[model samples]
Target: MRMLLNIRIPHEPFNAFVRDGTIEEVMAKIPEAMKPEAAYFTEQSGGRGAILVINPDEPSQTPAFAEPWFLTFNADCEFRVVLLPEDLQKAGLEMLGSKWK
Candidate 1:
């Protein structure tokens, strides 16, 4: 499944990491852990944030994808399943809607 990881880094740790220059070291590990198809960094809610798109082989891999960001930045993270247009087309929504009716 395609998953979106929303990461928000708190100010205290982010400031500390920046001061210590550990931010780059920590973030360099992200590719190895999440194997993200795409990633973007930006600001949100006046904090540092990132959006990562990844596909874990199984649900058990969730921790591996989330833990590094959590430990490094004390980040608040959310994982969401997302669909491509092809995935949406395969949902059988018409039949399900008719059944519900």
Candidate 2:
């Protein structure tokens, strides 16, 4: 399944890395390691943020993704299951709605 990885990096820690000139290396290294299908960076109200669409084989694999951010930047990471348009169509929503109704 495809999952969305929402990462929030706090300003203080992120700024420290920037000042130390480690941000470029650290930032580049993560995506290289994870090899996400898609990755995007943006700013969140709390700090810097990223949204990554990745495929992890099992539940045990969450740490493999989240730990890097946690230990590196004291970041917060959230994972949510995502469905493609085809996946939604195959979900049998109409069948479920009729069953429930």
Candidate 3:
């Protein structure tokens, strides 16, 4: 399944790493672990943040993807299932909705 990963890095250790010039070293390792289909770096709540689109081999594999962020950056991570237009078309929602009605 396709998953969206939102990583929110707290100010303390992340800012310290930035000031000490080690932020790049930390960032380089992060993507290597996930091999994200798409990745974006931006700020959230005045802190470092990232949004990653990933396809894990299995649902059980999510923890492995999140561990690096937690151990390295003390990041607050969230995972959400997502679908593309094709996926919605495949979902047969109209049939289910009619049954419910």
TM-scores of the candidates are 0.92, 0.94, 0.94
TM-score, candidate number 1: 0.92
Query: Per-residue lDDT of 14-95 in model 2, one digit per residue for the tens?
Result: 8988999999999999889999999999988856999999999998988999999998889999999999999999999999
- Residue 31 Cα positional deviation in candidate 3, in Å, after optimal superposition: 0.4
Candidate achieving the largest lDDT: 2
Q: Could you give candidate 3's per-residue lDDT for residues 33-96 as a string of tens digits? A: 7799999999999878999999998989999889999998889999999999999999999999
Each model's lDDT comes to 0.87, 0.92, 0.92
- Model 3 CA lDDT for position 75: 90
Error of 1 at 68 (Å): 0.4
Instruction: Estimate, for each residue in 61-84, the C-alpha lDDT of model 1 and write its tens digit.
Output: 988988888887788889999999
Q: In candidate 3, what residue range of length 10 has the lowest lDDT sum? A: 25-34
The C-alpha stretches of model 1 lying farther than 4 A from their native spots are: none
In order of lDDT, best first, we have: 2, 3, 1
